[model samples]
Target: MENRNPDRATESCLVLMLKSPGRSKQRLAASIGPLAAIAAEHLCYCAFEDMAAWPGPVCFAPADEHDGGWLAARISPADAVVPQRGRNLGERINHVNRTLRMRGFERQIFIGIDCPELDERYLEQAADALGDHDVVLGPALDGGVVLMGVRHEWPDLGELAWSSTRLMADLEQFCNALGWRMARLAPLADVDTFEDLDALKRVVGEDARPARRALGAWLANDGHRPETQP
Candidate 1:
């Protein structure tokens, strides 16, 4: 895709992707304690900082903006949207992408708030790839993706199947069917379960002070009464 606007380089697109901090997963934190909200806040902060200097505008879509307006202020001018009702994650993402494109952004990238390990270098690479590719993806070690970017008008948001373990593969197949060249960055892991938290601890070590503190506090008081399954 040719740079339709030279000034766009100074204005790369970004979306601070998030869902409401309290919901199904909210109860998990209750079991663990107050650290749940803190953990969620930290992840959002990490994601915001990671893509802070990208080439386009940064927008946020939270499930609710009551607390979001304040949180969004920490990042940039943000727009909140209820995650698409009656839809899966893929549909919601595609909806956000399409909304942004209609607003005149030449390129768009959506990132999840769960991946604190995500960094700017990877985002920069994705921006650079946008110069030639229709889509760029940062695949996660798990069966999902942490980031997705598009340089042109997005296709039908409903065309792609979402939230399955095959999400990444399904997206690739969609691009192939459309004859779009796709690019990928190195895979990274996202924090999801207790095991994921343990891995993050190992990777960051004592230096993982903040996340560790938050995780510890959460585990200490979370009252979910997590069950062990055989």
Candidate 2:
């Protein structure tokens, strides 16, 4: 993709932290059954579209090394496919952050496929926020962060409460202790449950991205059953 903001393009990069589509969104699976995998793929496609449109560099970090090929095939050929290494979320994020920083990307923004509303605009906002603040967080409505951007290497995040509602609070407190300047973006909902999907459908009406529109159609028509059963 062409760099929309050429001035900051070289220094900033977006890291997409992802798990295999077949293995993701287990919580949503409880409500949607096996269709969660299908939904996961759609969410992945949504992220791919956003990343392709991003002005700066974009990298994909797959939880498993075995999924590297799968991700590489989907992302832009120029985008790096870095496999994640860590027993937990915090460690994994720290590893990717450290790795990318060493690769000359001083400003790194991390996001997941769970938030379809995340787009190039949000990526640009996060990149811009990193210019003045030491850290930038895109607050998720469920008391978590949909996006996290940093201008410098992060402190030990291994102890932070990840994937919990206490995540946002814990992160803020951690940053405060280190005296890091923090900036937060507007809150957005991340899809995790059937209720979350329902709320999203009501908002993403016509003119939504193709992947998102297809997801909405599948949910409205076939309902829980995916177009093809796995």
Candidate 3:
């Protein structure tokens, strides 16, 4: 299939994503204890820095009002900062998609600030895939998707099971139900568990270094997992 050519009138025709970190990744926290918050914050900071330089219009949204304003101060005025709406992750994503589509953004891609390997090249590939397919998905090792791109408004995303092992599989079914042509990218490894972080550290890239440092500190301080209480 031939890829669609980008419009010459505009400088670039991509909708980048940058969602803020606000008490996310419970499994990681469960493994690492209270320091999980610190890890999340650091991971988000690194991702935001990298995504800010992507080759398109970047749209950032925070999970809450406090984080939104905090992130707004850091991003360039050229980039757009959007507030997250809805009570659930699926709802927020669907709302963002609908809003973007209504605002004349036909082709859009949304990624989170969780994955270290979800860099510019991966996103560029997703954007390029959009030229041929109606939807593109990047699967995560944890059975969740790390990236998703669509050429139109898909209001049915709220039905998707988020943050669960069934997530990626459910998304494929959702796309098939809508008859949207789906393209896929390589599996993305995200930091949901210590195992995920360990996997990332095996390669020792700049993205994985901060996480490793944070984990090392936590381990040095708290050698064992905190005992779960009734």
Candidate 4:
């Protein structure tokens, strides 16, 4: 049987599955370099820490052995285990979900580290959605998802085709076929391309203090250039 936290098991848990800071996607180097990675890591850390203060358990679903130690040192030791199988994203996420289910977590919300705009309000909304639906999704502008929450252990890994433009559509169809009610939160943009970075500047504002400071510091010293193409 899964180990259930009497105080939090029934409440929703947030699972942040991430590649350790140093091992993030290298394609970002053309636009933001290590700063992009740093920003992503900071976003994940902040979300995890913020959600930890919620009325539920917050877990880190680190991607590898190296990440295990690094993440454990930064987050709670009682968090979920790292996934052990699959080279593909779909299989890996399914593995994590299965592991969490085995550990007696009834509801789970999983997210990536790419969206800095993701905050506590989104987390709360996801949890609330679980009260009426079997799944909740926060779709990204890139036709992928930034957040997914499930009320139970769902093994429909086929629904989520990782890194594809059809991912959201596939998931929606899969949920319909499974007779699972699905809910959606507002869509957010993921920072993956130069266009994405440009959009961020617009949304956050070019003159915004922290935004400007972060971009200036990154551009000044970080050896990164704007991508000519996505």
Candidate 5:
């Protein structure tokens, strides 16, 4: 049974899944260098800035238990912190959703900080979609989903394909099997490789919040890669 917070029973919340910078952006790290962690942190900062004025509730799911304090310092004091649990991506997402649903946030949107283009308008669209659809998905150009929101508890997601090109299709079939009405937002890009980072630099250059603009400038200056000791 899901626990319900009476005060927030009718509210919608954004659940951001994050990891400690030291442990994030593994693929980017493999492609770039030690600077992947710094890049990841900057992306998260951009996300934070984007959500700073969101009208709805917001919470964070940290991959590690010890990151609560670290996350706390970056978010508003009213935001909640939930520790992620599960062996795999699918399971972990399920765990976070279930936990939040139990806590009285009936409508919830989940996103990762990897999508630098994600902003307040995109989130508002998802929240609005939930009013008419059971689920809303923001597709990634790489055949994955960058954002997912649900108005009700999801069916068994343990077996769904994750982190693969087949993920979007698998999720659609899963939702179809359960007769859930799913909506899709416009596709976006995620920063997972050196090439993606380069693309993000161009994106933030045109129009971005303060944090993202700073990130764009850093990328322009090749700040992501530091000089190695001889």
Candidate 6:
């Protein structure tokens, strides 16, 4: 069912999911009005496209009611389709990670659907990093985390500050407690706030095609409209 390279799939597994658009990205939606949900949906779609293109096995769990959308039907059922659970970001992520592990994947990476700058090459790097390091983290410019990968099992990160600037630091403390060696990738921006959108525009110069296109459209829409307090 999974048309993945057997050798490659044995080494790494990718976990991805999309939450219902109307229920997610509230801050961005508040900043850009209804377009926020549209942008969030677009970002996740592009992420799925990008990650699905990778050579290894992919675990895709799209929880949205697609309303008879084509992409949902196109997804491979070989990858697990578990909807997100738990009360917060950390719990949901932990739930997903543990589920993937039960499938016997040696390395697991959890990527955010809304992080436009994320692509397949970075995922390759993370999977390769786990061969040596126990943990891998891709930090966000806004002080949140964008990607987290692991090769070794650990406790659920339910206690970490889910959306605060202190989240990565708290994770570092957790790693310290476990005595796990961690690896780092360069920090990237996630378009969670208006300021974050601005920073992403500044940092994502020439390489990220999907991200650039998404930002261009969102920026144009944002510029032509007046801001209201959400």
- Positional deviation of 93 in candidate 5, in angstroms? 1.6
lDDT of 5 by residue, 98-213 (tens): 89888888899888888978876777788777877899888889988899989998776778777788788888888888899888899899888888887887788866488888
lDDT of 2 by residue, 49-143 (tens): 77777777888999996578678776667778777888889999999999988888889989999898876666777787777789989889999
User: Which regions of candidate 5 deviate over 4 angstroms?
Assistant: 1-10, 225-230
Please give, for residues 81-151, the per-residue lDDT of candidate 4 as tens digits.
Answer: 55545677777778888887777878998887777566666667878888778998889988988889998
Estimated TM-score for each candidate = 0.74, 0.91, 0.80, 0.78, 0.90, 0.81
Clashing pairs in 4: none
Worst 10-residue lDDT window for candidate 3 reads 7-16
Q: Model 1's lDDT to the true fold?
A: 0.63
lDDT (tens digit, per residue) of candidate 6 on 72-110 = 565665655656667777887777777777877658887
lDDT of predicted model 3: 0.67
Stronger candidate by lDDT (2 vs 4): 2
> Best candidate per lDDT, number?
2
* Best candidate (score: TM-score): 2
What is the per-residue lDDT of model 3 for residues 21-129, given as tens digits with 9 covering 90 to 100? 4467678877866656666775676566546656666677677777777777877777666677887788887777777767677777777766767665677777778
What ordering of candidates by TM-score runs from best to worst? Answer: 2, 5, 6, 3, 4, 1
RMSD of each: 5.7, 3.4, 4.8, 6.1, 5.2, 5.2
Error of 4 at 40 (Å): 3.4
How badly does each model clash, as a count of residue pairs? 13, 0, 0, 0, 1, 0
List residue ranges in candidate 2 displaced over 4 A: 1-10, 225-230
